[model samples]
Target chain A: MSTQSVAHDQPHASGGKYVQIAVILFVLTALEVALFEVSHEAGPTGFGALLASHFVVILLALSALKFWFVAMFYMHLKFDLKVLRYVFASSLLIAVVVISALFVLFTYNRTLWWATGVWK
Target chain B: MTAAVLDHDSADAHEEHPTSLRIDSRKLAIWTFIGSECLFFAALITTFVIYRNSHATGPGPKDVFEVPLVTAGTAVLLFSSFFVVMALNGAQEGNRKKLLLWLSLTVLCGCFFVGMQVYEFTGFMHKGMGYSTNLFATSFFTLTGFHGTHVAIGTLWLGTLLKDAYKGRIPPNKALNLEIAALYWHFVDVVWIIIFPVVYLMSLFAK
Candidate 1:
């Protein structure tokens, strides 16, 4: 409505910060690829073996960090309105829930499908 | 009039009508759309995870995925995300040249990413992993194909914005146009951020 309010709603723009975040994202991505290589080559025998054991967790953590940086900084969720955050987070939460439910259902309870005749 | 004054005037006109939520409706709508997209992609990813190992008689991840190629593509997409943000920053600062330069780079990165995906898909096909070859092939194609489609769409969106900027249509006050496109582009990047690790890397060890 008012110019003052419009200006207040606009998030601060900073190219330097975006560049910094991009560098961080690139580094994280490199780490992910390197971790994968080490784990794959290690073959459960050494330090790479240890990394291989926790590879999924480590990789997912790195990926989530990259996701967070892009969502919060690149997408301006960090500076924009809280409602936007809620909207995205809630949807993401539901997505996570759906993934978890499906994984649990299909992975551990594979028989449930046959038992319920859903596959039939 | 100074760019600052023009920006203020534009913002005021952009929101002359008060919204019930006290924010730009377009921004809110875009965010909502992004949220729904998360669910859509999540479903695709879930199917992939569920069927990741069901290769029956076709090529699997290790057979078809070239990690180095995909890693490079991922880097390009990530950089594009950065480029778009810079473009938005320039637009908001009323720096027309900066906006056009960064936006053009962003579009190029988007195209490159899409091109890389096409190459990867062709490679998969050459490796005998057709869309209906097996469960793994089907789900993998569906998931990554949708992501590539999004990249193409986003590239077109940014290309249009770049054209607009070149034509001097996007002034400091209209930076919201580019900003919205940037948001969508960033969402695509984040989706791949998840897809890369979950679908590509993790699938390497999938039993």
Candidate 2:
């Protein structure tokens, strides 16, 4: 790469932005914990129960937000080259797919050999 | 062939040759390694999820997991992620003192995290959760243990870079070394970001 392109690809130092991201992440984590606590106390039949039912979805959404912030800002993927983005994102996509499939398969088929018995 | 010139002051000094992707090869390689790590952790996580409730032979998640402690560790790790980036920022700006200071704090955070994990594992063992005690124990140990190992490795990498900075080797031109380490550190942090909620919090309510 030419000097100019290399310099252009280099991200500038922005401590302020990083600190802001960190604060946001902290708040999100607190929210996650708070949500868990609240859901833990939800009643069996009410709006609270409704909220309790969707707890996993909400928690995952919050976690995804935190993941995005760290990946974009701390990892500098937002400012890095597009090729790097493609490589990381593609692999992440495959990983997500594999995880989803495994969950679905295990959830539906509990009689598989590996799924049988605690000691086998 | 383009000769690799050592600038000793510019960040691109170690480019060696023009990469086909127009990026530093080391940076690209680290990202690729991180990408594959995603799948590796994914498989481990899947195993845990499948067997999370198989603790019928021993203590279960609710009986063992302490969310409060893990939340504190999560915060420390998140803060360390911020610290490492600031260190990178300092390094890229040619501010040696700032780099060393933040890097040192980051390493300390890493050590604290690992120590906390060791303590948590010991507590789990005390509760009769050995590696082969049950399915839950096995999967839980394997997953979190690997993550803790990564944190330890990242800590050593950053510690080495900190030493290099002390020797005036990681100048502005060679900040790529620190930057690569920072990327790995941040990747580990993000993986825990997922694990904190998915494994720890969600498991509390698992059926």
**TM-score for each prediction?**
0.90, 0.90
Q: If you superpose only chain B onto the true chain B, what TM-score does each candidate give?
A: 0.91, 0.91
Q: Score the docking of each candidate (DockQ).
A: 0.55, 0.50
lDDT of 1 by residue, B17-97 (tens): 566676655577778888989998999999998999998697888898888999999999999999999998888888998
What C-alpha lDDT, on a 0 to 100 scale, does residue B130 get in candidate 2? 91
The segments of candidate 2 whose C-alpha lies over 4 angstroms from its true place after superposition are: A1-5, A45-47, A111-120, B1-17
TM-score of chain A of 1: 0.82
B138-181 in candidate 2: lDDT tens per residue? Answer: 99999999999999988987887888999998877677778878
Q: After superposition, how far is residue B161 of candidate 2 from its true place, in Å?
A: 0.8
Indicate which candidate wins on lDDT.
2
Q: Which ten residues in a row have the lowest lDDT in candidate 1 chain B?
A: B1-10
Q: In model 2, what is chain B's TM-score?
A: 0.91
State the TM-score for model 2: 0.90
* A32-85: candidate 1 lDDT, tens digit per residue: 999998988886487999999899999989999999999999998999888999
